[model samples]
Target chain A: MNAVIYALFIVLPYVSLVVLIGGSTYRVLRWATTPKGGGGLYLGLYRLVNRAGQRSYLSAVGHILARMLAFHTIPKNSYGRDYGTWLSVFLFHWGVFLLIAFHLHLWMPWLRVGAEAMYVMGMATGTIALGAGLFLLARRVGLRRIYGLALNALDDYVAITWVVLIIALGLAMRALAPPGLFGEAVAWATGLSSLHPEPPPAFPLFYAHVLAVELFMIYLPFSKMAHPFTFPVNPVLYGKFEDVDEVRRRVEEELGW
Target chain B: MVSVRKVTYGRGGRDILEESPMYGEWRREFEGRGSVHVRIKEETDEGTLKAIGVTEMQRIDRGASPAERKRFFASRVAEMARENRAFRHHMDACVHCGLCIDKCPEYLGTRDPTNSPVGRADLVRRIYRRLNKASDGLLGRDVDDKDLARFLEEVDLDRIWTYYYQCTECRRCSVYCPMGIDQGEITRAVRQIFVEMGMIPEFNARTIRGVYETGNNMYIKKEAAQNVLDFVLDDMRQETGRDFKAAMDAERADALLLPSSTDFFSNIGTLKGEIAIMDELGLDWTLDSRALEVANFGLFEDEAHLKYIGDNYVNAALRRGVKMVVFGECGHGWRAFKNYVAPRLEAMGVQAISITQLTAWALRKGRLRVDKKVDAVVTYHDPCNLARAGDLIEEPRFVLRSVVKELRERVHNREKTLCCGAGGGLLTDELMPLRVWAGWPSVYDSLRTGAQYMVAPCSIDKAQFPAVIQYHKAPIKFKGVSDFVYAAMYGLDVDKIA
Candidate 1:
């Protein structure tokens, strides 16, 4: 029974993550390959990257890092009166970052002592983050403009459900489970290289938490979260200058301006 | 190449007056006469407009508005808004921050916030929003005739006209706008509104009428255009004398050169240099005497006029059988040809390239040579139309730096470059003071570089720069790229360099 539970917890989540990431990458590649006229896409991309490169490399890297840490790319002022929704977004993003760092400890050998302390901090932050995210979900449903702009069937529900489930299971495994069970299970799994030690039978909530997180990662890049990967390029492309008159004149004089 | 025969007219419908010297002179002779109609025909040999006899008399009601005038005028706005997403988006997205205050030439020059593009756009937006709300919700009860009248009165028609006309529809403000609100689109829309209100500027009105009457905006007869070319070439010979020729309607030419009519009448130095540069480069280029204009006033009006002006260029190109067509350095003209005309032509099955793009191509192809040593510390001015509307910011800098030596580029160059105060057809007697005021910011910005000379590859800037520099008492000389290139290549033996 314990062996079955452990397989379901770790193996299922790993499979789901691989499938989601691989599938989304394929789709993005396909979309990029679609043929278009006028070289707008290529030129746009070149202009954007080149402009960003024109700025000192240190400045570009610093900007990107600051945005990642603070979510500074999103404007702070909402057109509508919804302070709670904004706060919820802020809390949730910060919490997600902390939680991801805590999870990485399981894979990173050097972070064992620090990871334990971080896990406790992350759990505390994650609880508040989960609550804030729930508040956002409720606000989206209540607010007409937000509901209209933000809510689509697959996006709104699939994302919300995944986040809520992960939070609930994580909380259960951390607070309600027998003392030392969570850490012991992680240790046992890490030590047993080939044996694949079974999860403690009583820690079923831990299995559910792992599964939820894996599902979330799979869906992330395909949805609105993908903005992180794309939005930074806009300013760079828009900043470059291409003098059409000079280009037109050269073309006229040489090829036919 | 094209010829027009002068036919005279009298007060009576068919009575002949006297034979005139030229068709344009004949047309002028009959101006304010009872009525005169020009008969235009295309000459096969030269592929130019051949004139038949002119007829006169029978004055129709000069002030009569078109049938369904209100609906017609309303529909024009509706159509323009419907087609131009940029115009609609800019109008809708305005936050009224008044940040565009410094960016507007009129407002910066005059220190009047009301003249800024954002302020003008806000007026339009408020009116549009009010109309929309009233029509949709209150069943038109929310807005009454009295309220409409009051709104109209508060709009400051003269100030609006002055400021809107003052804008060259350059997109400098749009560059800094957080919402991507193009002031050009806003100004164009405002101009349309003025046309509806029967408040068109006199000079602009005349130019539009000229475009309608003659194919070109200046109303230059084919003979007169040819004569002007001859006059300029003779002047060039006296000045530089290297056998410079202004080829008109030459068959199978590599390029169709469209010099602004203003360049011919004024700024003859720039014109001479442009011709000389082309000659020095050994390029196969020709000018068209029949359609000797790059400035298209139709951009300020309805699509019909836009199409009409664009068709003239396309027709000229097709008739001459040129491989490519190049426009002169006029801001709105470059914008019209590149952003509006070229795309429209492609849609109409007449594909052509823009002058700037062609020039950049030539540089890339090594057909044109530039000595960077000759051009040092050169700073470029971004004509708003080309910078914002046409998305042309870098090619000029590249071309200039490639030719001139030790070019020190301005930091706020390209998209952030300031506009010369004389855009938007505002360089008239009435707007002279306003032009000086509006041009102050640009003067300050350019003067910071302490460069000896400023290079603007725009014909309007070339015309406006002297007055602006003179008004401000700034010690900076303005030169077009062609002038600089020509001057740099003056004594360099082409064979030895090659």
Candidate 2:
């Protein structure tokens, strides 16, 4: 393999993995240590599933999942144009999530996803993601052009524009890849994970897709893309986890109100 | 308060900042965010909380020269950006999605870009982002030195002070954040950092200090408080021909009333209703002088003070050995009690209930009789804190329906409520227009009900709605639910309220 190809595929993947893992770790730990002062008891992970609280921990989890993941928090005042914003947001996020989920077999070849099934699901998800990505880009730009609203010159443009590019590139690869191209890519993926140096597909689209994915991973920790990982810091609900009375009885008796 | 963003920042009010090229465009974008937006005060006033021995007040640049102040601000910003987790997470998490724009009353009222929740969060977020990028530069990442400097230049002591203070910490924007990032928590963290540097708004500082110094938020001494309570009791006696007695700081009682200081000074009608209900129920209840405040100003600043004020309740409950603690008609205060202090009280086997809850229970039990409907059409406004955080949406309405001739409902009620803008200690002379602008939606919504009287269980609403109603020249009268209850108990018109 050429040095450029080797750096992009082998060296780049390892480097991206290191930065992503390290940066995400730093973010999670940093958020966890931030001084939360509302007198929470710093309950253990058990508290998450602990059924003892006034509002069941599991119930709180369900509520928060419905809120964050399910996009249940429609802005109270998002009546007219916001419905469009909501639709674009909903389509783009869920499309990207499913696209990524379907791509999981590349990292786990033993799943044995048939090529026909892969082609069908990949085309569906990729088409959806690509369309939603273009729509989001247009909406972010169009709203600013027409309405002069939520126009972040830097963060918003960079974040959305990058997603659109990544999705567009992935769709191109998924639609037009030659036979055995994906097999080579899968061999490269498994080999890379197992520390063998099999070359990725020689196709330019395959190289472009992998490079973009790696760079995206590196950028993930730097940008607000880290939101999903850092969500524990901003948990959906402030529901109490412990049965306060029971804990209080067991706790060291402080004789103040 | 669906105010359009005006094109000019030449407003004559103190709400408009003096022309500065640095944030001039930002100012123009938010020109009409509220009726006016507040400029962060350049100097501290008489009411600024002093370093009163109990709290350690750090003066970063209080008595420093300009150069020293600059250095101090830089150091504090860097330290907080790295050490404060809440600020870091929020600054990193917000994607500047404009969903928060229409949601924030400050932004909607003023149309100021910085008044927007995302805008305000970004004002701090930009500086902190630069700070983070600078730190990231240590790892060999390319960062623009001039860009960081420019972003840092956009925020200074005054800019940070002005924009952040505009947020009432209402959490209205947080409700819609898909990420669940609570901007209220971010505001409190930033405010606490400023407060540590002896930079606090006089109104918030004074209120907090008053709670610390005296038992109540208004710092009315025991004699003055007692006189007001006595006068209220006497007024009730003459009107209703029923002798209602209330004790202050009773050694023991079945329940303790954590009344807002306004109950004694500004809204005695609420006091009268509370007294009559507790008496009618035939339960032993006492209003403790040491813990009469229902406004927890500590929530606007820091957790230490939140705990400090909350301890007054714990100590009051322990001292009285009360089986229940009945919180008064205060919005944020009840929220603080419910989310933070109530569970602690419940843990100790003492039931924590609101006055609205108690009155609703009493009325529901058919134990308290309403002789006649209040001679008016009434509308109810849900205080943001109580409805959103305190689980108190229907109780006040239940009590209102029990007494009013006709109850009209506003478009925005219950958890999806608008803020009084006067909340989060924003009820100051400086931000009067901002308050009015923030109060516009609710005031007008209440007016739309064609109700002669508009009532809310929140003390802040009772305090804010009157001024807002007067400003808009809306003929709607604003009162507390307790006031209507008092009038209904005696078959009196709303005008009978003194």
Candidate 3:
């Protein structure tokens, strides 16, 4: 049991961390080095900065952020049809947001709370994540309308299912299991953060959740979930608007204007 | 080489391309006539592309062996996908939410998944992914030549030709895409790759050849173009008792007007409107013999032709010493002029502006006077290139509303505009049925407004929309925006002219 806990809580976390960082960097660099027509990312930005007036660029940034974070670019007409999917996705994302906030209790002293209060918080966020994740999975698999969209790959299903399992295991450990495992779990989290692999608490559900999270981390960079990193780099939504005069000026300067 | 797959439907049956609701109605009268399918296939040794009059275009024999063609295809895709940040990002970023499926006219018209932006983009994206997997060593062993050849064989080249050519590169799908994946850009890139292999559509290739050989897409010689201008001006003299002399090859001019060669040949109403506007404004504008054309088919082809044709006009402008270049009402021509040509010419200290912009400016300054409002119910069709690609959306409307009584709006207008069927060199005679079907959305939208006249400020729309309206049996007269503007002008009263 101790050996299993050590592998899941300590060694596996570090392995996942290394792969997450290295794989993501490699993915970014692979795309960055590819030769493209027109000016590269920076030149596109430079043109945007030149073409859009000062006010328009700032507003354009605001518009890009709305689209990236809020899925603002989804067609307005599709709202009535796909609102449930949108809502489930939002709930899942917000649940992840709260989960990240909850995890900070491992390091920050002020972030900690009473055991019962933590239990309530965990139940609330966990339920949202689990429910939303299941809804998304069901819609992707069961809904014939969405099923016809053609771009749904196998990884989409795998990625969502993996995260949902992690959420389910977490809720089970926190709300249904005996309430004595919280302190030891935090200690293990702090010890791992401090680069010391502590023997995790003798709670099977806790280890199960942690193991699932570690696997998810390793899988993150390989899937479309890597969109969080690459989305900002996309030229379509974020690139400079075309202004003939501004581009001409830049071209002229290159021609010794 | 690409060949069409012929589909014969029973009378009152669904068209196999798209499960179109009207396909049943379209076939109601068809006892023997069947539509040719736009689906793509690979060229076999026994059957080749049955394209006619395309010998003038360049053709490349990529190599004798299948392995060689496979290597060429893979390496070219990798090179292009790697170098272009937009291409790389767009290729990687599609989440396949399917938001862009219904937004595409080709997909809506054909109901073929391959015609959708995401589906078309994936055809090219899969090649990029295959090359990425091989080079990145995702597989334990590097992808060998045999595997690459097998992969290449699986990739139907004729399908790539049919679908990619079928796309108009309108960029409408990019507007509603959650990730901003411009699949039109991918289509253009794929088309450019095919051009590298010396595979080009006969329509685009022949038009490009004409531009090089005769300085225009329609092969209008200098004398022929000059004579057309003379005849139009002479008609203008008889109608309005106004001597309209368009300066040609002038030593120096304040503005140089570049109308599409189509305007000189077929779109005489638009050409005459341009003459009236320029005459009324009384600007020091010249229509030079060297730079008489504004249409750039290179935009439909690859970058080399784009540069060649772009430089041709720049050289003409330099030779004539014009300070400003005015692009007459044309869609892709204005895109090439505003986005591509204008910037390069700006460095040479010449200003490139659209005729719509000039008209808007003239209207604002009260330089060009209107006698009376046009007594017609009109709705505007926003050309995709002008609205989505270029930012000339409001100028045309502002000019039109000043002359016309009521300017009705289509269901999808401005940046969200649907493409006219005959764009990106899909304007050939053979694609007439496909063009008419693809144009159903805009034509249907116009009919919903109950407008008598469909006004569009584009040469392509002028040439294409009339056919679409006639085929759809829609009760709308297709006219250029400037045609109404000319009718509402002081000299040519709206009630006096045809």
List RMSD in Å for every model shown.
17.5, 6.5, 6.2
TM-score per model (chain B)? 0.75, 0.87, 0.88
Off by over 4 Å in 2: A37-54, A75-81, A105-121, A142-155, A193-197, A235-238, A241-257, B1-37, B40-56, B81-84, B134-154, B343-349, B370-377, B405-408
lDDT of each: 0.54, 0.70, 0.70
- TM-score of decoy 1: 0.58
DockQ (CA atoms), all models: 0.03, 0.25, 0.32
Error of 1 at B340 (Å): 2.5
What's the interface RMS deviation of candidate 2? 8.5
Off by over 4 Å in 1: A1-257, B1-84, B134-163, B235-241, B281-283, B344-351, B354-360, B370-377, B492-498
lDDT of 1 by residue, B1-498 (tens): 011111112132221112111324323432333111211111112111112000111122214453333333333444444444434344334433333544555544443444566665654555554443412222345456565555544444344454456566666665544334567666766675554444445555566555555656678777887787788777656655567866877876766778777666765655765676566557688987767778776576433345567678888887777655667667767666754456544554443554444455567767676543363466678776666555555666766666666455654566566678777666566655555555655655566677767777787787677777786577777767655555555533211211
Residue A40, model 2, lDDT = 40
Best by DockQ: 3
Question: Candidate 1 vs candidate 3: which has greater TM-score?
Answer: 3
For model 3, state the Cα shift of residue B225 in Å.
1.4
Model 2, B215-259: lDDT tens digits are 778888888888888888888888878899799888899889888
- Arranged by lDDT with the best first, the candidates are 2, 3, 1
